[model samples]
Target chain A: MSTPLPDPSSEQLPFEPRRPVADADRQRQSWNAIEARLQEAPVKKLPIAGWGRWWWAAAAVLLLLAAGAWWWQGRSGAGSATSYDLAYKTISTRFGEKRRILLPDSSVVILNSNSELKLPADWLLDTLRQVWLRGEAYFEISKSKQPGVDYFLVHTDRLDVKVLGTKFNVNAYTAQTTVALKEGRVELLYSQRPGRSAAGLRVHSMKPGDVVTVDEGPVLTPMLATAPPDVMADWTSNEYHFDYTSLAEIGRMIEQRYGYEMEFETAALADRTMSGHLRADNLDQLLQALQITLNIKIEKKDQLLKVSVP
Target chain B: MTTGAMPSPDLQNAWDRVLAGHADGLRQIHEALYASMIDYACRLLQDEMLAEDAIQDVFVKAWQLRAQIGEVQSVRAYFFIMLRRHVLNVLRSRQSRRRQQQQWQQQVELDPVFSAEDIRVQAEHTRQQQQKIATAVNELPARQREVIWLKYYAGMEYQQIAAVMEINYQSVVNLAFKATQYLRKRLSG
Candidate 1:
């Protein structure tokens, strides 16, 4: 850190990046933009591009943005695939944030907070729809009876949920993969890809209301048959339903949804269990509800939210 | 190879006028430094529009704090410092945008830092020797790229570069030394 730059800099032949001449017209426009900006309130810094052309620029920018988006994907390698030229689309949400996306086939996917769903850039994998998911999501499949349209597949690290005209929930996080079918049928394929697992590893068929959670191995089990709507899929409505769940658990959900760090004033507060549904639209609303329900005082300091008995 | 640090009487008057917040002062200074600043920024950010935007932001910041800014020593280097900060900010925002939209999985080493090879790949200068220099420069890290550009391209002295880069003078010298060693090793060996 203390070394001095040598006299010749690098190699006695210091390199410079290529330089392009600036356009005089753009300089004049930028000057005008700055001058006009000076006349306005001194609070706002002027935009680099002239603000006069913003609205029209917005539409033009959208077209440019699409191309920019493609370049960005390639630059970042988010697609993480060997194939190039496919405009891969990724949808991710923070904790407490849920996003609904309609696929090209009209299938609906509602991603829960702290989750991601990625669709391949093109329909290149034959007629089947394939998606990669991390965290949790609720999917309502649109029955595509058209010939050549295969079933939809949602892939996780350990398992793949294959659906066709089925409504299902997939919770795939580290060390656990849970798939709960609401209606219709689905197939849970474990390490189903060729060369991944033993040849005998079979695809498990799932019936409606069937909940299968697998860890190191595929374990099929049924969740509550009449699991309350909130516990099952209340996230779709932007409401989280917790039944006798600990305050610590609720705090974790809020942290995941809103990216707020939750700190309890007393250890006992974390152990207190409550059951109810809280809105996920805003942090303030959820905090207010918590304050009223738990009889606790909540203090928010930037990214940290503190819970204490009032 | 002039550092643009040798302040002429005209440039001094421009500096005084900018301090006084005169319209002509701002115009004169902008005309004097606009193109060169853009070129310097283009080295940091390959996108021409982004480079332009960084310089425009620099002008805006300059105007915003014009009254408080007193007589300056090297107006060009001072503005160069400001432009470098803004370009870094733009690069950061672009990186975050990429992360948000595409979910950056791998660490992408943008070795060139908008070097000429990245911007003007087809400038009819792809001869063997030029190609070798380009390849060697492109292999350097972004920090080395900036230091190399500030030293040789912008013609900034070590002290001025340290001021512009907000690093200690010795640190700048050491960085330049390391960059030189790397280039020498690569270009010769």
Candidate 2:
């Protein structure tokens, strides 16, 4: 532990990773590209007086964003499979943060807090519209007018949901993958167990309001039912809507959203379930609601939250 | 190549100009930090073109978000932090693909013949010593390499490095110490 520190200043560290040389032409070309883009979007200067003028700029920016989205998606048709392999893009949200991402084909994905969605960098430009999800996301896929390439695929650890331009919410935070269909139809494809052959892959078709939760068992058991209107896609509106969700599952959601570690005073406390909604904007408020509704006491210390029966 | 231990006055001035809605300020900031930023980005993303594109996006985003950006302690750290987050997003997207490539690389490194070739190529003294240092630095884990680069090449203090890496000051100090210890052992033994 008493080893003297090595002085880095006295020694020459010859580990330079390709320092860019001052090439005049290259510099000019790079600067010009930046300059041209800057010209398209000017800095917002006036806070109040610029409101009227700002709306015009806002409209222009939206148009440019739409066009850029189209360009990225349109250019993907010519790229080879190798290019797609090298062109994966991941969009994620930090604790207590949510983001809305518009895919190449104009499919909208509202990623939940502490969630990640990985897809081809060019959006839906891949021959097969495919994406991988971890955590949770609400997807409103735009139906492709074209027949052969209309289906979209969402892969999780437990199952894959093949979509035909439907609105759905996917929660894959745990080993169990839950797909709640809000509108249209989706086909759930997964094997009963790992290392199963292609013939073992099971496909379960879903209709609107269908909620199928595939358990993380050696033999995966899928429980199919219908979720109430408010239970699904509620997080998208900044609310935690639970339909008799167990306290353990609620604790996991809290852990994911607020980066807190939850511990139960007794294992039995985790089994108690709660239903209905709580505003997700503030942590303390949500916890207070839990206390009032569930009659359990939660004590928070630093990064840990402990729940006990009152 | 050195931009002083203190925050560069030119960068601060350029940032002020950028806040005031002047394109020339951005140009000055770009010209000053472009080389170092691009080098850092290239290390994070092993693709040259992607690094260049990422740098360009950083500058463009900086200009766009100028109005909302609050006062920053150091301009260099701010730009580095911004670029770091941008590259991390890109890296996360390519995680599965890159993991496979890294597994293949580990298999190659495990081959005895590859180590023999490395030993035979170390015949020359001075040049080999330099190469050995480079290889040692490169062989360090990703976080260690990042710490070493930010400290030595970027000439940043531990506090600034912590801010750029979004870690605590103690964690940065520990990482820097751990990295130096590894490098010393590799170079001496």
Candidate 3:
């Protein structure tokens, strides 16, 4: 295969003919193919009568004025109206809440607390099954038997999880996004910056029992041997297991699950580690268990939970 | 055919005629963009007949919506955008219908030869084959391939490419740069 560096000055491509010449036969065939459809729908013409033309012209003038003003506004707003933000429908869960959503394609998403999922509003019309995720979510994506429609994409701020009908848990609430696949296959695509161009993008395929965490930089750690996939997804069963996890990390999880402002007496206390299982479903039970396990005093003033060594 | 670096005055005049409800004007626009549009759709859909159908749909829809299309900055960009959207929607619906039919067949007939696993593997194979462009360009991701196509082959600026691809302009610029760098390195190596 011949690969020539593309020349900006030239109009032709290196790999294939940039534009195949439209020979007479092909052009005629194309014209004949579309001529019938084109004729079926001619441009609708407004009826021009004596007084109606004047009214129509006045209405057209007003319409043009409004359109011009809108055009100016759109230009000033940097084309926000035409941007992709309007194309999505967002579903969010509040703190201490979990919601189950059924996508248009019959896929199931179990949204964890304080997470948001932005699904394309026009899913049926779109060629891509793409959804934006903020925070953690467990997904059981329905597999597509068709060729072009099989790819499902889950986009986070740090990574994109591409899968073909896989069961996986994604935690994107923090700076680092972790993806643990329970069943089927998944491909993690990420760049140094989320939604960056394909240049910095990296793709890593994950099979069942695979766990990968992606940070803001080039730190991608695949911890399949260290962490069990079942432990990763056990949160769905209301089980919290920590193996030598730092108190700072546990504080973040408590904040997300209960909407509390966590405070430690000192930096050392925040860095203190714990290893145990806390199966409490509610905040009080979890806090009681924490106090009993760590020999610490907990003071709750409204929504703030402060920890201090007694 | 022009590479569409600049929107031609001829296309602008043809678009004006189209807005004025002239079928011949629409014919002119169609004839001018036929080859490039077909090539683009064929590359994306990989089926000439479907590509032709998609082009026909674009023209018919363009004529139908001419009154509402108003004055676009570039008639070439408008048509390409319309063609791209129509082709994707067609592929999505066609594939969706095929999927429903497959599920129905599974429930009713349960053919051992055409099992669900066979179809899944075949679908996976087709996806791999789609990525096999048989050139250094094949190494680029799907989105990068689009950026390369629009920048090099379609002769579109970053802004126009961004509009058609529904991404931001900066992304298109970065993608083009990344793709060019990759292609140059691969070719040189």
C-alpha TM-scores of all predictions: 0.42, 0.48, 0.46
Winner on DockQ between 2 and 3 is 3
**Per-residue alpha-carbon lDDT of candidate 1 for residues B58-106, written as tens digits (9 for 90 to 100):** 8877877876777778777788888877776766655553454454444
Evaluate all candidate structures by whole-model CA lDDT and list the values in order: 0.65, 0.70, 0.67
Lowest lDDT sum, 10 consecutive residues, model 1 chain B, at: B108-117
True contacts kept of each: 0.47, 0.32, 0.47
Alpha-carbon runs more than 4 Å astray in model 2: A1-85, A124-126, B1-189
- Tell the DockQ for candidate 2: 0.13
Give the DockQ (2 decimals) of all models: 0.18, 0.13, 0.18
Model 3, span A1-310: residue lDDT tens: 3122232334321111122324455666667656766657465746545785476456444433442222123112211011123244556666766666666576888777777776654454225677777779999999875567688888776677899998999989876778888888999887643335577777889878877876645555434433676677666766788899887888889887567888999888888888976676556656777777877767776777888997
Candidate 3 C-alpha error for residue B3, in Å: 66
Q: Which segments of candidate 1 are over 4 A away from where they belong? A: A1-87, A94-96, A124-126, A191-196, A199-202, A215-231, B1-189
Please give the distance, in angstroms, between residue A106's alpha carbon in candidate 2 and its true position after superposition: 1.1
Best by lDDT: 2
